[model samples]
Target: MSALWDLPDYDDHEVVHFVRDHASGLSAIIALHSTHLGPAAGGTRFWHYADKTNAVKDVLRLSRGMSYKNAMAGLPMGGGKAVILADEDRTKTPAMLAAFGDAVERLGGRYVTAEDVGISVADMQAVAERTSFVSGLPAEGDNAGGDPGPFTAFGIFLGIQAAAKFKLGRDSMDGVHVAIQGTGSVGGRLARLLAKDGAKLTLADIDADGANDLASELGAEIVSTDEIMQVECDVFSPNALGGVLDDASIAALRSPIVAGGANNQLARPEHGKLLAQREILYAPDYVINAGGIISVASEYFAKTENREVDVAEVRERIAEIPGRLVSIWEEAASSGRTSAEIADARAQELIGRG
Candidate 1:
């Protein structure tokens, strides 16, 4: 176990390096935290962690977040995350995925993995080749898999609307200028949906071409990723990674609403209060981004049980975010607590029960 994982509250740990000699690559590092709720479940993030320590920190924090996310989202699962560090020259191949599949099988469903950053549907398919534990598989019913990005974006979008209504008394997204801080798969899909609802978009990404392409396709303007924080827009959607809104970024924020699909969007809990004071309607990241988990949860349990996930049911359930956000905002105002605290309380209560 890493020294950092020894933090007083966290109670469990597991790490595996799925190496493929044929592909000369490492496939994944799976982490599970089961005691918090039930089995650990989270997406597979494919990126280069600076070291084993950093990777451990990410997987630990992420798995813990998944526990809270599921509890808050009203699901029966706990939290877990898988990471695949790519060497580019040494790894990333079908054989590597097969190796990852073996690693997942070894867990015996104590942790479940799905699609996330740096991973694709094909990768999940490869993982699926090794374990029945994998979700986001082919259309077992009305649910099909290419990626869960759009569905996640929809949940965030609805949560944003909820934030807007709670903070601004607005019911529609019409004419809302939204500055998106990362126009990748999830962010791009979110931009399109918001655009469809008549929200103007100012988009940014490290991939200039990808950003520009999405901007052009959506009739939106492109900005440098850094500029997104200071854009004079109604909503600032940090659709990238965690810690984007730290003391530095929070001090520079110009929007009244901050919402998106990024996990752990706030550098720390106090940032939520900074938003509250700035009158910025900050949607809790885990609460808003629960769509992918909800989808995959259905796949994990429903598909195997041969039960159908009614599309309307899932969509309707997603729409509930706005109402929940509205209530949380009101509660925060009345109690003088950060909305995230309120949210964390809810998650804690749920997890505490089990």
Candidate 2:
């Protein structure tokens, strides 16, 4: 049971490549979950984990999620993910980037990586110095490129709108209450978007200063991290890390709808059933969070083909996210299944794994 295949999150990943560069103090894992549609494409996450096993477990799950994400987004790519184990201090160096890029290059186009949590366009610049397989490169005006945060936030906002309409019968965010966890890139932007529509917001983050500043800017209320989920609100959006919507969390949720940009929101598949039992309208994370990958994939494909990436086209694809969510929600309602289950089944069919 200690073996890689025995890991609960493994899911028969096609490749799990480990890289170690002692000179650069680099240790990384790249996992490919599928290639049925095309080469595996996902982002590289540079995070500090407690141990190697946890890191591997994270990559395995993330890679599989990416596969589902890409498939659900109707992209011609499979899923893969890379993780660089950072030191406790989270120190990053150019040498480490170069070594990681080299590792990606060794895969020979089997994997494509862009920015994820803790990674940035500047860091991807360093990685691109060693490999052309990187995405999120800076583009000219009105092109599909650069950081994906705004695009992701936009999609989440749209999905929230859809969820609100489907679940709460509200046509607008006006006076709607949203309790948001993690007021970082996606969450903060989403809060601003909702505020523009007159949403009453309650925000929380581990980084108190940033969250406080954002709350001040939007004239929204702020709360503690430990209490965001149980807040009495119309929507509970988790824009932080994954695995927060487990059994106990679902039981404690006070919101009628759960929709956010976080990946793998359900800790396990069974938790989706728990949400259904509670009648909490769930937005499957992969479907709701595909905006980032949509931007990344559009940019990546355009870069490889020596063509100008159409910004409008990318936005058009991103706008489809809400419809997909609504489809799953309605289907689940009529079919007696969870939104997560419906989304997963659709993704599995797309990836040739159903």
Candidate 3:
């Protein structure tokens, strides 16, 4: 790989710490994009990468997205993310979690760690044993801190409704057909919420059995992972991973709108322009997925201050997601710039990068 600064995803990052604890086979990278809003806050993703450079790229892009996500969501937090390199079997261990926690603790509270991709609440609990700067612990009764997947799904659900109103002239998802491309935590919950709205659904996931089970519950159709993107639907929600909206994929989309909990949906900056050229309404991923970080930040801050978390407040903040998307869409319509560009500029301004 080139110098860290030369990486395309590197965006004037404040800090990038490469951590290794050979004793536990722990190797990770933590990237901090900004702290203008507050302490850099985001989740730690655990995944096995065939090419480790992709891991670097992921932390860089994801940390920056978290910065944008938090700023746009009006949170008093900046952006930071960590990626723990796993082996082919995706092995994880307590010692590794402890080492990672020690790494975060050494940051002197500049970085707050939580759960992401392969990391779980139990994993985070283990990490918290070594660091005070952690969140996503199981909720105290009636509190706002826990797995953020449902919250993220709720936000995406609302944002999709907003897009339908703005682009399809539909107030609700009553009869809308939405093709969802992941049956895991966020995507599955999103499917459930959309189902409650009486939407027609077609679902796909790398885990075929899981997808089939979810489809059974919702009376939805199941498609192969290869076919989900090309399904003729009003919305194509990519909730699995990023870089799915590259040139060829965007060219193949049949949906009028693309929105989901996936981060960095655009493979490159130009892809946003391509979406615009195709006249597809793209819901900037970070804005729609801010729900997770919102819950994490609230829990962390509330714990630090010895105060109770307000569940209603968290939902109220998530409720604003649709309005933000509407504003971005409106600006894109009026200025001829892509929604992604407008959202980036707005986030940059908020982080004092303007």
Best candidate per lDDT, number? 3
Q: Rate the local accuracy (lDDT) of all candidates.
A: 0.78, 0.92, 0.95
Per-model tally of clashing residue pairs? 1, 0, 0
| Lowest lDDT block of 10, candidate 3 | 308-317
For all predicted structures, in order, the TM-scores are 0.92, 0.98, 0.99
Better model by lDDT, 2 or 3? Answer: 3
What is the lDDT for 13 in model 3? 98
Residue 246, model 1, lDDT: 84
Instruction: For candidate 2, write residues 1-354 as lDDT tens digits.
Output: 288998899898998998999999999999999999999999999999987798998999999999999999999999999999999999999999999999999999999999999999999999999998888878789889988888889889999999999998999899999999999888999999999999999999999999999999999999999999999999999999999998778989999999998887889999999989999999998889888889999998887888877879988999999999988988998999889889989999999889
Q: For candidate 3, write residues 1-354 as lDDT tens digits.
A: 799999999999999999999999999999999999999999999999999999999999999999999999999999999999999999999999999999999999999989899999999999999999999999977788999888899999999999889999998899999999998999999999999999999999999999999999999999999999999999999999899999999999999999999999999999999999999999999998888888888888899999988778888889999999999999999999999999999999999997
Name the weakest run of 10 consecutive residues (lDDT summed) in model 2.
302-311
